[model samples]
Target: MKNELWQLSACELAEGIREKQFSAEEVIYSVISRIDEHNPRLNAIVADYREEALIAAREADRAISSGEKTGELHGVPVTIKTNVDVEGKPTPNGLPAFEDLIAPADAPVVRNLKKSGAIIIGRTNTPELSMRFTTDNPLHGRTENPWNEEASPGGSSGGASSAAAAGFGPIHHGNDIAGSLRCPSFCCGLATVKPTFGRVPAWLPSATAERGMLAQMISVQGAICREVRDVRLATRIMAHADPRDPFWMPVPFEGWPEMPEPVRIGVTTESYDHPIHPDIVESIERAADYLSDAGYAVERVATPSVNEAAESWLRYVGNEIKTYLMPVAMEHGSETIQQIFEWFFQIGGVSDAEDYREGIKERTSMTREWNLFLEKYPLILSPYLMQPVGAWDSDTKNIEELRKFLNSGIYSLCVS
Candidate 1:
């Protein structure tokens, strides 16, 4: 019996399948079975194509046996956020009116993943238009956190984070505009990386709005992984320039050295006036101190001002998501969607166009400041949140609390 059913990383499984210690089909089957065993309870995976996945796995095994060379991720199982397309699957983004819509073609990221030999097993749920953090929408209901079931796994990439954290896959593809990748990893104690903007391709059909300035800054497609090595792996595999996204640079992925040298490390204990909870504060201190102990020069600094950029970023992002919901609001005449749009427009309108421009200036200044700081400091160790992971309380029972919970993570992480 080839007992390959458990928490092995992608590399491990790929090696196992290559050596014939186990079949890629076996791994896909095991993952599907495990997800089926848990998904109904958590409501994480909204639409699963287990049969297709298993068949693909079998084909992968046959190809390997035929001595055909496969990409780096050959025969590995993985899942994607529902916001992106998968050819035949629906890219719902959690809108009920749009459930029938299907992608005629795969998003560039999906194409690369398949080309790299990753097996597509499932498409996970996301908040409506992946707007807010917690994974809840009309289409998929809600996706519970795997750790402390009551707590949020963090979103809009919440499902991807939960699946990866729960051992559903070695790597779950996700995107980040505001801490979507990093916040969940913080909540789950998983390692995540937010690559510089345009390092990864993003060509989703559901996106009907222009990229705005976020095209240049503050948006990235990164990974949440258990090992730093996987961060490097995903970057190497997916960071290649996709001309589809003209923003992507025609540059090769820069590989990290065998050992990153101990350099100047900047530490920010309080990025905002937001008090860091003791447990989280201690965690930050420990991380900062570790770098110091490792012989890196540590410098304490005040949190950089992110308020202006945050306001602009929120308005632009909120408007984009609301625009995505506009068609739904029209078809179903949804009170929720309409009201959300009204509120979004109200706030966005209040910002004079020049105010938006000023915010961009603020963002540019901050980025330059960070760049200058990094010029001397090779690394910056900072907190992903103001608090520790707490179980979600069902009693909260209101969208207001959910709103607060969703914004708190970004408020905590933004200043630096």
Candidate 2:
């Protein structure tokens, strides 16, 4: 029973705890034991907080015993990605130079999770500056995929994905900028949702300055979990309003009036210049078939210009990186990461100052096009990455490989 406790979902554990079938301590112990046994090889968790988590669990159990009101995630163990602020912990984001940059307060998502009764078991790893498509850093080293060491677990949230897949906890807090949440989940066979921007509040209290305009628009906070229900639960909890984040919306998670009986779903398998894997095409088809059988009106049709949107993402974000992040990377980042950033500039087509300003305005028009398209279809079934998961070092091999990788994820980068 103790061993099997590690397999329970967040919902199951919470229900059991509330019903007095299991204590939060039992769940925490089980998860810590799992981490102790498996994390050495996986390197998913960068900072272990087993002692802190156990104490929190005890407090949570006492609260329930005293008949105090509890939040949705009462006594549940979760891991936070190292990139975000966790108050007093370092948000290194995989760079050794920033190891001592301790957070002054919890990020909005972390605060929301704690308010919901979630305990942080540990902080997970990420690539240097959380920029790459795979997780590896000079500070914490590489996070190995639980299934295969050679395959990437996915990044910038690869550590979160690895922990989720390896059963370290039911919920793993991860943020997405460019496929960080979705890519890792895809590689690790977990479920996740890259919540629409402003749906979840985000603010890194440790940061010395504000992020670039494009960064604020594209990046979003979310989670990865083993079960869809847990993803839904975690996302809702994380989406709770925090006064720190001005972008947060006071919208309900559910209760959107039901769409007509058969919901319209637009399905696209278009890969543009890149050759999409056959399995991906087949998987999309199978999903469409299943949706159709489930009474969704599935149609294989093109939507907005993904290529153009992707180009815009590259242009706008590339210029921002060049202006803002490049200096930091050059000074404190690894030689490999420095080279990777160069490749990014090459393929991203960094725009001039005038073009960058124009690109920012152009984003509104692009978003309008997508919003209009989404009105008719309501849902779009599209590939997150054109190909299956690649090797850990696939993107770092050469400029061409990195370019291909960026191209494959056009949908992910653009859609967000």
How many residue pairs collide in each prediction? Answer: 2, 0
Best candidate per TM-score, number?
Answer: 2
TM-score (all chains, Cα) for each model: 0.88, 0.98
True lDDT of residue 146, candidate 2: 100
lDDT to native, each model: 0.69, 0.92
RMSD of each: 3.3, 1.0
In terms of lDDT, model 1 sits at 0.69
Q: What is the lDDT of residue 341 in candidate 1?
A: 52
Model 1 Cα shift for residue 119 (angstroms): 0.4
lDDT of 2 at 46: 93
Worst 10 residues of 2 by lDDT: 253-262
Report the lDDT tens digits of candidate 1 across residue range 1-416: 33336478887887888888888988987787778777777776777878888889889999999999988888888788888888977887778866877888887778888889988888877777665556777677778888778787777787887787777767777777777787667666677787776778767665555555544366667666666777678666777656677777766676553435656777766544544678766887898778788898888865455544455566655544454455656565345445555654554443455665776676677778766766666676766666665453321345544444434455533431
List residue ranges in candidate 1 displaced over 4 A.
1-4, 206-217, 256-261, 315-350, 390-407, 410-416
